[model samples]
Target: MDTYSFLRQLADSWALLALTLFFLGTIVWAFRPGSRDVHNDVADIPFRNETVPVDDADTPDTGAKS
Candidate 1:
């Protein structure tokens, strides 16, 4: 068979199966047990500095008049 045909068959079968397995494996790994604390820490990243209110003096002044 020609190179194109060989590559096409590989993509149609083995490549597809490999990609599907990789996707499922990622999902399983992300949702596995004992990962709650890690996930929660990452989720709270935005609110990490909530206790400290931002001061307006620390902000850069944009010349545009409000």
Candidate 2:
């Protein structure tokens, strides 16, 4: 068989199977047991400092009249 035909056959079979397995493995890894705490921590990153008050010194004055 020619190179093109061989590559096409490989992509049509093994490549598809490999990609499907990879997708399933990723899903399984993400939803595995004992991972809720890690996921929750990452999810709360934006709100982690919510209780802290913002300092006015950190704000840049644009000099626009109120």
**Could you tell me every candidate's TM-score relative to the true structure?**
0.74, 0.73
TM-score of 2: 0.73
Candidate 1: 10-residue stretch with minimal lDDT: 47-56
The per-residue C-alpha lDDT of model 2 at residue 66 equals: 75
Q: What ranges in model 1 sit over 4 Å off? A: 51-66
Among all windows of 10 consecutive residues in model 2, the one with the lowest summed lDDT is: 47-56
Model 1: lDDT of residue 30: 97
Q: What is the C-alpha lDDT of each candidate?
A: 0.95, 0.95
Across residues 1-66, which tens digit of lDDT does each residue of candidate 1 receive?
999999999999999999999999999999999889999999999988787666889789988987
Q: Clashes in model 1: which pairs?
A: none
How well is each residue in 2-66 modelled by candidate 2, as lDDT tens digits? 99999999999999999999999999999999999999999999987687667879889989887
Runs in model 2 lying further than 4 Å from the true structure? 51-66
